[model samples]
Target: MVAVTSSVPVTDPTLLDALRSDLRSADYTLDGVRSLLGPVAADALDREEALPARVVTASALASGADGRATLLRLFQLGEDVTRAALDAVLPTLRTAGAERLGLVATQGADDGDAVRAVVDLSPYAAVDAAGEVDWWIASDLGEVARRGALPENFVLGVGGASRTLAQITVREPRGSVLDVGTGCGIQALHASRHAGAVVATDIDARALAYARFNAALAGVRLDLREGSMLEPVLGETFDLVVSNPPFVITPRGEAGVGEFTYRDGGAVGDDVVRSLVTSVGSVLAPGGVAQLLGNWEHRRGEDWAERVGGWLTESGLDGWVVQREVQDPAQYAELWLRDGGITPDRDRARFEGAYAAWLADLDRRGVEGIGFGLVTLRRPALAGAAVSPWRRVEEITGTVAQPLGATIARVLDAVDLVRDLTSEALLGRRWQVAGDVTDERYFTPGEASPRVMLLRAGGGFARTVRTETGLAAFVGACDGELTGVQIVAALGTLLEVDAAALAAELEPQLRGLITDGLLLPAP
Candidate 1:
């Protein structure tokens, strides 16, 4: 384990209160910063380019700008400001309070009495399924500010992965929720809005310290603990479990490979994610759901679905795995290398060495490509049920709706409903096409009838399904006015086929449409 220092922010109530007041009074918020930096600079900052933002902030400071610019320069852009300027901006929690909180440090009389931020503090705002939130997050300064590789125990603030997990998480109200590997408490903070109680656990003590401070700053309560995955919550169950675990596959025993606490689990070849998928069910309450983001390897002569499905098979829970992206081994290596700040332009030899190590390690294991995606698992509500555990593993590499929590909840319900029903019972229910669904028909040049048909959804996963004439007619006739049996019988008569055979042929497709949100059960 890596040794963590005490340089993280402290949770002092009085100082925090004062800091909050000053921030609010100065309008140090997302909109405020955006207005100050304008669209170009703000967009540049989003791309991790700091020069435009630095130019804007430096100009603002030279012309005696407001507190927002000062804070942006000092805390966000890693620029130093005089103690007098900082005190003026943070009148309530002055330089002394900031120093006490470990947010900044003074350069003494030799460096012109300047102060620099030791940590990164910035505004965060989001309007998720749970509603809108505007808060400040504090974490380790990133490579953009440090101009070098991140420390092994670096605690990350809101990044692309954090936002991705937050957007995909199912956010229905629950009694208890657990956020595993809660780096800087971003997901836990979002969970607090819908859950009655939240317990966030991490193996890194430095991460816990940052999470604690963030919870205090946001005025949210989280039962924070220090332990590896599932250890802190042993023997306890939660209504929901969410994790953005350290699933990155870094080469072990490689000379230049970095062991980052935030990304690497110190395990070999996607085991961190596999272990979580197979074991998270032990902590889920009956009918509870666990949503996670992970990466799985696609090795030679092995199908990715079968490999990931094997994990689900061992979990004893209904599961859905969506592979959103795939990268070849070489592409995967370069991505993580640049992510760790070892760019070819900066350190050619080190970058080449690390890249070689990554390829060698992956090749040794017969790995060809890597699959990244979302995983959702559910414990059956009725124990010892006769129905087989349901599993859906697929690849969807395209645009989809944001805040997919509601769609996910609905899909789970649909799956459960269809799983328990017999073929005849399912046929007895009336169904209708979702409003977002539409069909396209293609005909041979001058043919009187259409030859090919397709069904596309505008929402949810934006799935498109190809159909034959019989299935297309079935979907077109679905208006919640006729049962499945009635529609199939009518189509059978018109197509000169047996109703029983047509029903059997279309039953699986209907169930698939329902689970994918293309069709819905009538009220």
Candidate 2:
């Protein structure tokens, strides 16, 4: 195992307060950083390239840019800066105070000594159900800054997956919430907004420390625990649980050569995700929900749904899984290898060995491709109730709604509302077409009426559904002015078809439309 030096700062209350003040005074927010770096440099920095940022910052400094530029160059780029520059940028924390917080280290004894950021601190902003929020997030430096493979226990900052999880998580108010593997506490911070209490756990001590520090910086309280998977929350039921766990499938060899605690769960071949799916429900309160992001192995002749659905079956919870993308073994290995900062062109031999080993492991297991996506699990309100569990596993590659939390909440509630309602009962209630739903028709040019009809949602998975003429007419008639049966009977009368036949065909479609937000239950 390669040893890594720890550079994360201690979370001292006094120092944190001073740092926060200094950060705010320097306008070190996301908008502030973007304004300082300009669009090109910011976009380049976002792609893990530092040259554009370096050039921009150098030009800004030469042109007499303010404190924010200096702070961004030092902390964000992991570059060394003069002590006087840092002192100017952080007058409240000063040089001595920053050292005490373990945020920076001075190289020489003189005032001209170079100071370097001990951790990567960046400005993050997101708009959720509760409105806009801007925060300063701190984590271990990335491979771009370190210029090497990540350490085994490195805690990652907010990335695409993290943001995806946050955006999809239902933000309803709850009594208690759990965030498993809460590296840097991003999920936990979001949870704290609506949840009465939040618990965040991680197997790595370093990760827990980072979480603690981040929670403090964000002014959110989190119950920090040190354990793996469900160990920390044993026997503790929660209203909601969310995780962006270590679900990455890494080939384990002698002494766990390439295992990372943040991504690898110390398990082989997607078992970690399977285990979490099966076991996480044990801590869910009745009518509770758990959301997670994971990857599952797709083997020859094996359907991805069956592999993931089986885990949900064992848990006895209603499961909804969406496979957003799939990658073959080579693509998967290359993506992760580059994520770990290993370049095939530069380190050909090492990359080849690791790549060959990963593919060989997949070959041994008969795996063809890997499917990555989201999972949402719900515990039934009543264990022995007549309501049958709903299991939906499918693929969705199109763009989904932002703040999908609202869509998820609507779907879950709609399922409960109509779960026990028979076709006769379903038709008795009035329905309305969602404002975001639109109807489109396609036909060969010059044809009179449309040959195919499509019902599309502008948000929430942006799903598009093909409908026959009868179903399309029924949906168009839903204006919250009449009952579903009234629309179906009226459509049947107009189309010269049996009313019951039309209702039977349209009832199932109604359920799907409602769940996908194309059809809304009347007020």
Candidate 3:
């Protein structure tokens, strides 16, 4: 790919308004794009394969596909078009207006001049904790459009990581939010929907420019700051802070390896993610919440939980870390190498060198594997409130419910509710099974009594737990009509056991059930 000097997108309010209006009028939205491409082409595009999309798009356009297809081919497919064709799609904005906004560049001085997109623009739709939303986002063109490695300062549009952070983020209405490492401002845009004010910060000027352009296009206001990590937000406290930071653990001082601003935080090993985990607590207001994605190195003889728990201990916040995936050093290296468009077939020697450098760096640091996961931290509402802070580290690699933001909020609430409740108090309250929970029983052949009983959750983390006979009976007895104490006492009577002993035995398990969301506190 030839090197091109990409300028920061222009930010003119009137031009942005006109562009938004044109897009809306032309029905250039996620649904519109999907309808134009259909399922197969869209699915192919999602996999980063453009041949099917190009074929379908070409066929559709040849058969008189409308304005949406033309815009899609121009902006998303990176196809240059005649001025008249672009004008037909963007009747309100036109070629001149788009050029003024820095969205496109004109190649020749004529009405039939070739116009090309300077940035990649696409429609992003999501169902966050706050229902559904649709917006147009602009960022640097990706490998699919450029047909090569991404530029170092390339701003990323909405992708898998963006959607993951969005879906997992707790989106309750808040006073303020900070979106650190906000490449193209996707998270900040989602924050703006629920937060009173949002501040988006990034170290890359080009990224900020794309973020500004995207916010303006979406008609959402943001305080765009230029700095690294938490530097821009120092001395500021926010009720909610969200980030999908550059937590990729890359080998430092490795020559010939491109350090993309969107993935590399200029730190060796996993220091970048560690620093954020330890220091982000300073910017969180009392009772504030911060959710971020990170990669942690699992060194020799240390469990993944222990390593991540150490970071939480240093941060002094209530932390819950979920390890979603782990990759060996070699696999991790190859994954990122291919991501940068460097493949064994294209550049075998270069690929081998980069791979060897990555493995050597991991070996030097005694890193066995890289663990990627989501980290959620909350500042205790008041000093000394979490003297023994709530910390949970687990792995859930299986499928979970979509829009986990709501589930996360519920977990936080449940944690807080059960943290201070005494065993006596917990048993005194009425309890009921959650709607998404079910009981499963396994029996030995020709046996009346089940050999094993399990409780499974159908949503959220999709958790499963083995239950004892007494606990299983107790859960079956809960119907929101009786208090836990009544059910336990009745069970104890039927089993010829002491009521107090049974209550004592089941108290901790009951608390676990509550915290895991299999059981709910009845009103």
lDDT for each residue of candidate 2 in 392-509, tens digit (9 for 90 to 100): 9999988777878988988898888778788888999999999988899999899999988999889888999999998889889888989988888798889999998888888888
Q: What is the TM-score of each candidate against the true structure?
A: 0.96, 0.97, 0.97
Candidate 2 lDDT trough over 10 residues, lowest sum: 1-10
Candidate 3 lDDT, tens digit per residue, 395-456?
98999887889889898899889988988789888989999999999999999999999999
Task: Candidate 2: list runs displaced more than 4 Å.
Answer: 1-4, 254-257
User: In candidate 1, what are the lDDT values of residues 1-523, reduced to their tens digit?
Assistant: 1122337999998999999888888889999999999999999998889999999988888898589998998888878888888888899999889989989888763424888888899999998776799999999988787778777778889988889889888888999999999999999999999999999999999899999999999999999999999999999999999999999999998877677899999999999999999999999999899999999999999999999999999999999999999999999999888887888898889889999999999999999999999999999998787778999899999999887778889899999888877899989999999999999888899899988789999987889999998889999999999999899999999999999999999999988998888988888
TM-score of 1: 0.96
Q: Which scores better on lDDT, 2 or 3?
A: 3
How far is 151's C-alpha from truth in model 1 (Å)? 1.0
Tell me how many residue pairs clash in candidate 3: 0
Error of 1 at 450 (Å): 2.4
Query: Clashing residue pairs in candidate 1, if any?
Result: none
- By summed lDDT, the worst window of 10 consecutive residues in model 1 runs over 1-10
